[model samples]
Target: MAAEAKQTCYEGSSVQSFRFFLEHSGEHQAILQRVHDILPGEFKRIGAGKSSLDFLGVGSGGGELDVQMLTLLQSIFPAVPITADTVEGSSQLTDNFKALVAKTTNLQKIPFCWHIMKCEDYEKQVKAKGDMKKFDFIHMIQMIYYVDNLSTTIKFYHSLLKNNGRLMIINEAANGGWDILWKTYKKELCVDAITEYRSSGEILACLKSQGLKYEEHVIPNTFDITECFNPSSQTGQRLLNFMTATDNFYQSFTPEIRAGILDLLRNKCSTEKDGRVLFNSNLSCILVYA
Candidate 1:
């Protein structure tokens, strides 16, 4: 019944998995800090001349990161009002984001539209409209992996950019802490029909092959998953499941395979320093047409 119920990993508690990621991993801080450091300069170079900015956020999550990025943009162009169009596939996440916006006084001031559909669906809708609207800035943060066709998704989003507009994509770098485990268990764990586990290196290669130009930035970050070493740790088990994009990885794999994966996660993927198990989970950002 468990196996029968498990149709696709993504259809599970994605919001819970995302919450686990933010709570345990340093991704939120690392991403926000990188944007605070790098995005201002990029925005300055663009030099806004209009009174309003058309911004599209693909998979903007629960508006936590969107608010930060929007605030940064406001600081850059203090006079211009931002018209934000957010795209998110998860209904729960979209509702949470809207709720946050409704409760937050500052977020209410910013005009926004929500598209509760997948990127491809949104693309089809826009194309069908006959008068497709272009955006000045489009950002996809750690969301590309959700799409099946990375190349097509990138090109589609790139096509939506106005002249001198910027499209920023953030994803994991190749050979990171989880690379070995991912390579080993991907066939069994990954939902290839919906998700493609491609790192930044692979993405760069794709861009190069397609003759696309972009700037890349590597953000150094780590997360503590020492609990994963303990067989009895439920949090560790969930973390492993989230990392592998599987449902209960500890129970999914055979004893031998599970042991091998745990060993790799402990020794190769992470290191024990000062009594803490730190993982080598860094991220990278690729700025296209910035």
Candidate 2:
């Protein structure tokens, strides 16, 4: 669900997917159109139809990305049964995910299963009952924040795959301006310093350590002011919550300090430009072996 108006327990997990879907899907779809540029040999490896794909997502908050993935998969492998496992701690928007499943069209008729366990735990699960080379494809999106050990997590994802299986990861570019924004969020807006891990290199390194090769995608996205910061938008409301909530944030900040920061941000992120508010988002993604 779009929990922009509330203090989402899922944080950036699901909102990123939904926001991108709503705001940038048109342009972003172009990137999807050029998927070959990103996956190259891996896309060819997914091969023909109905191949089993075990979709693994860590920090899958509200699952909008699952919807997108389902669409992508259906286009290439019609009627293929996909087993989706999402590791999310807790989210105020859980109900939104249930709704997403019901409305999904991409893999609507295909068999789909969702497991709400931790990604780190999948290592043990694979070792316990299943063979390492079972799934055909695996993916991890912007949910790396919840991951405890990147190397360990990647190794496990690799272990779960068949020889042809591949892994994919998408996240904000670590060197982008958003890095500073995230830093500020941690330094100025919370009840405590957020211990949540959010590093892109660490994830890539983990995959490399597992002897998995990957391709990277660098694209631009936006967060419109009307949608993200407008007076009535859900995201706008969430921003208001940030304006008001001090003790629950990661910065160990007092409420007053957060309010001051938001005041400046609101002024900078204007909402009168397009019919919607807009801000540039530089997005980077990588797809590796499963």
Candidate 3:
């Protein structure tokens, strides 16, 4: 680890918190490109022609993903006006975000235009900007789950775009993560939908309701949740140790429940004998607006 990373470089600095996670994990560039790949080259040509651009992080998290996106924006547009609003209902992650902003060269270049707000408030900002129709791009990543009404949020995002602007949606490899979690756990996510996650069909339905033109693709991809570590092979204990470092699966459960969850997760991960445990993930990307 670098000297700064090893220390509490920005422990109390809320802004840098999100930046640290991305840099520490070395995931910023990779995930940024993954989301970037969803947009065709044509979108850039279209975006380049615009006078100003906006990125509305539906749930603009404070970590790696945010940094990565900002980096790409700098790379592609360099100095075009980018006013990004990362709206979140809760400010628990603000410190992380602050730390990230402090250290990130790209983020520092642009003014930190965090609303510390919610999607509903976006309309006010949109109105103030002239029209809800003037934004270049509006994105909601892993945040639609927190929305009380998916259709309403979708409509809101679409409303923020100029005729040629873009709206992007990204979620985990599986929309079914929510479904699976809900089935197994009684605790509910914030989404008003009884369904845990939105599928491509579900997302498309939202787009159509808003009368927005859009594109969809099954972005085939995978990431080893444990990175190169394998619990069953020579790295087995090391992998377990890495997981142990964090609270991991124990937070949500009683002692017995946690033990059972660990056994299941670990067993599914690998065994004492042969192959390494490899996990697969799917990242879905949806492009809307222009």
Which prediction has the highest lDDT against the true structure? 1
Cα distance off (Å), candidate 1, residue 39:
0.8
Q: Candidate 3, residues 195-264: lDDT per residue as tens digits? A: 2444455677777877778777555433233432432543333322222222122343467754543454
Against the true structure, candidate 1 has what lDDT?
A: 0.77
- For each of the candidates, the C-alpha root-mean-square deviation to the true structure, in angstroms, is 3.2, 5.9, 7.3
Per-residue lDDT of 1-290 in model 2, one digit per residue for the tens?
11222332344533454444445324345334434455544544674544565655565556665566656665665555666656554453455666787787555565544555566565666678665536666666555654566677776676667666776776656654344344456544322223443546566666666677777778655554343334456555544443323322324346675565444444542324646545434556777754
Runs in model 3 with CA error above 4 Å? 1-30, 39-43, 121-133, 173-201, 209-211, 219-274
Candidate that would win on TM-score: 1
Q: Give the lDDT of residue 43 in candidate 3.
A: 48
Stretches of candidate 2 exceeding 4 Å from the true structure: 1-42, 48-54, 79-98, 104-109, 130-133, 184-194, 208-211, 225-237, 240-280
TM-score of 2: 0.66
Please provide, for model 1 over 1-290, each residue's C-alpha lDDT reduced to its tens digit, 9 standing for 90 to 100.
Answer: 00111322123475677687788887889889998888998877654576677889998777788888877787789777778899987677778788877887766678888898888888889889867778888998877666767788888899888877899988877888755667666776555333346678878987887888899999888988889888799989888877766667777779988888888888888879988889888888889993
Higher lDDT: candidate 1 or 2?
1
What residue pairs are clashing in model 1?
Answer: none
The candidate, 1 or 3, that scores higher on TM-score is 1
Please report, as a residue range, the 10-residue window in candidate 3 with the lowest summed lDDT: 1-10
